[model samples]
Target: MYANTPRTTATRHRDRMSYDRDLVHSVLDEAWVCHLSFVVDGEPRVLPTLHVRIGDVLYVHGSTGSRPLRSAQPDGIKVSVAVTLLDGLVLARSQFHHSANYRSVVAHGTATVVTDPAEKSAVLTAIAEKIAVGRAADTRPPTPKELAQTSVLALPLVEVAAKMRTGGVSDDPEDYALPHWAGVLPLRVVAGDPEPDKGVEGVPDYLRAVIGVTG
Candidate 1:
């Protein structure tokens, strides 16, 4: 649990909410893209990328020719990864009271390359499946040359914090009488109809099971 882990300067308090590890992992699992931040050449860089969570390990991929991937080789990689989901827009009578309702997770950890071929292949499959469940089995596996041209890194979720704000708008007591409505406009992510690519003979049962639908 996050409460069991010591809160340092980096992992200290979140003003709005208290979170356990389960809440944090749940938020991460629901999100597809994460922003990865690290220091390179004494300058900070943040990259938005797709990632997959397998247990406590988070996997990120890049081309073998990437500069940041090359820089991660010699020195240990210190990174901060974050994901945020906006749930609603909070409208209040006072401008100061305006805010957003969101759930977010921040994790600080060290990243290292996955060197084993078998493990690398499995991680790649997990990544593909995450994009669209069961897509990995339908597509051709990566060739030897393609495997050699890709880079994968694993970052353990050692220190993490989740913060969230929900419910209706909060307005100042004095401003509540002002001529403005206050409430939350909810939002959500819904999947659209699945479209097959050209030359596809038919969708398989494994894919149907993965998507929880049948045509």
Candidate 2:
């Protein structure tokens, strides 16, 4: 267990919650997007964007002028970032027992805009690799102008929590006799055939490996 501060503790369904760093990183790594929440002008704002976890730090990027990106600073600007992956839908005998099988991680920390040139460039590369393993190497590197136009925020994985629920529906004991269907409708993210670019050549082995496994 680690980073289990009061801010990361759950008030309900505590049994489903965890303070484990491994669990947090697993959920974060599998997620494609994260919802970053922060206060802007006295209003709570949540923005869905690309995020990557390199070691214990989470990096999110955006247009330099965007409110969330611009407002982030080294000063204490409290923020929370969360990633959720739904595994299945639980269909219960009764409506009240409905639920979802999901894995989620919520992290609370201060948001700071990354300024160091080397670190900033590395983070951008990491973000690209997160999207696709071989993508960063396949594409041309960003220019100085491109880097200047973007802003990246680094959120430390200090106070974090992970929650998950799996398995079948839980209904009242008496409702078990009901003639309604009760089972889990499993879900997954699968990949289809690769869409090649104009006049592209052979499919990269790394990408082919991904599609082969997912397919």
Note the Cα lDDT for every prediction shown.
Answer: 0.74, 0.81
| Per-residue lDDT of 36 in model 2 | 82
Clashes of each: 0, 0
Candidate 1 overall Cα lDDT vs. reference? 0.74
Query: How high is the lDDT of residue 123 in model 1?
Result: 81
Which parts of model 1 are misplaced by more than 4 Å?
Answer: 3-19, 64-66, 201-215
Q: Among these predicted structures, which one has the highest lDDT?
A: 2
List pairs with backbone clashes in candidate 1.
none
Residue-level lDDT tens digits of model 1 in 10-87: 343346544577787778877877888888789998888877788888777644345876558744488888888888
**Stretches of candidate 2 exceeding 4 Å from the true structure:** 212-215
Query: What is the lDDT for 5 in model 1?
Result: 41
Would you estimate the TM-scores of all the predictions? 0.82, 0.91
